[model samples]
Target: MQSKNQLVELPLFAEKQVTLVLKREDLLHPFISGNKYRKLKYNLLEANNSGHGTILTFGGAFSNHIEATSFAAKEKGFKSIGIIRGEELVDSWHKNTTLLKAHEDGMKFKFVSRDDYRRKEDSDFLADLTKEFGEFYLVPEGGTNTLAIKGCEEIITEDDKQFNFICSSVGTGGTVSGLINSSFPHQEVLGFSSLKGDFLKKDIDKLTNNIRWNLISDYHFGGYAKISQELIHFINEFKKYTNIPLDPIYTGKMMFGLFDMVRRDTFAKGTKVLAIHTGGLQGIAGMNSVLKKKKLPLLDI
Candidate 1:
């Protein structure tokens, strides 16, 4: 589905002489929202077509992918398995809102050690999972694959071609790659990296040959899932002003970076920018729990 592009009336845009429109992909669904919905679209169809009765995927404690996959699988009549990254979560998974929600959606969890989780794509590791789970369709960590990219490509439509720049949060790179593949040659795609590294550039390059893209490594706020009072403050204030909630993991960071660029006068005076709000808001409750423990300010729900 094509998400609405809402113009942001922030004073910063007027001051910078740049037009900023946010693509409300977050409104795509309450559970399977944003890029997650797009990423899983074709993957689920392929799994059903192949006659798989179960879907298995990988994620960390508060991964949006895990929660989205669980809901999507349940909706499609497929049992779901989430190979969680930390074995410690085995005992405390219920304390995590994301995991608990996934469990409530009928997803079974297999908490493994971080070391073991790293081998998720290894043939031997996958073979062992297949042996244990009895046959299941494997969706890669972050749900980024060929079919997922195909689904993400549909996020951009003819209506979006007017923007000179398209911005999105970079996770496993599938969403950004799809944006790059589908964007017009005249438009530049800027991927704000949620993870701290230039490695995503290489991974994204492998997925698409489009050169009209640049990976912005700043604004990760320490790394994936990591946030600070400053970022939380920005998120809350942005919501207060725009009524658009951004998750700390992905969309929040992307919007933060995009706004920073505007302040720095990165875009030309008349340049139009479209930022993708890839939903990960389900993780806010989980993040708020951590913030509470840290004695930090909580994000406004």
Candidate 2:
């Protein structure tokens, strides 16, 4: 039941004399949407082909990847294990809607300290996990893998070629890599990083030969999972104006960056811009809780 999400033009962009359309990839699924869906599409198939009954992945407290993977595995009839970072969450993790929803979806969580979580890619660590959780298909954190990039390659279609710039929010670089691979030579792919770092450039370069893409490293307000009142206000205002609910973690930041670029006249007057709305809307409630704790404006989802 996968349908094409609409590409709606933003009136704000019209004011700037620029054509900006949001590819509503968020409409793909209530749970699994946008890049999460793209990333997991082939990974799950590979897991099933490998004869594994369970899928084990890693993520943090409010990871959209964890939430999406949990629901996706449930929908696809695969048992899921989320190796969650921050061992302290073991006691009252239910306070977070993301983890609670995953738990409800039958995703067992293995809580570990932040330091221990860093060893996720180590062979010995993975071997120990296989012994502890039994033989399972391991998906890297954020669901970025070779299969993931393959799935993401499908995000663009023949219809998207009209746009000169293809933009997406980058997490683990899989989505941008896919976009880069599929982009036409006449088009440029721009990735706005949600995390603060230049580290993703090498990771993205490893996946594609297309030099038509560039990473925008300055948009991350603070760092990963870190938010400010300015970002919260922008998310709220954006929802009110466009009725497009953007998750603060990914799409919100991406949109904020896109709007900033538009305001600065980053692109030519007649340029067409397509911003991919990579879904993470499910995490809004959890984010709202944190915002409420900090006495900040919550996303008007």
Candidate that would win on TM-score: 1
Q: Per-residue lDDT of 150-240 in model 2, one digit per residue for the tens? A: 9888988888888999999899999999999998879999999989879999999999999998899778988887888889888888777
Off by over 4 Å in 2: 1-11
TM-score of 2: 0.96
**Model 2: how far residue 1 lies from native, Å:** 6.6
Could you tell me every candidate's TM-score relative to the true structure? 0.99, 0.96
Tens-place lDDT digits, model 1, residues 1-301: 6788899999999999999999999999989999999999999999999999999999999999999999999999999999999988878899888999999999999999999999998999999998998999999999999999999999999999899999999999999999999999899999999998789999999999999999999899888889998999999999999998999999999998988999998998999999998999999999999999999999999
Worst 10 residues of 1 by lDDT: 87-96
Winning model by lDDT: 1
- The whole-model C-alpha lDDT of candidate 2 against the native structure comes to 0.88
How many clashes show up per model? 0, 0
Clashing pairs in 1: none
Residue pairs with backbone overlap in model 2 = none
- Clashes counted in candidate 1 amount to 0
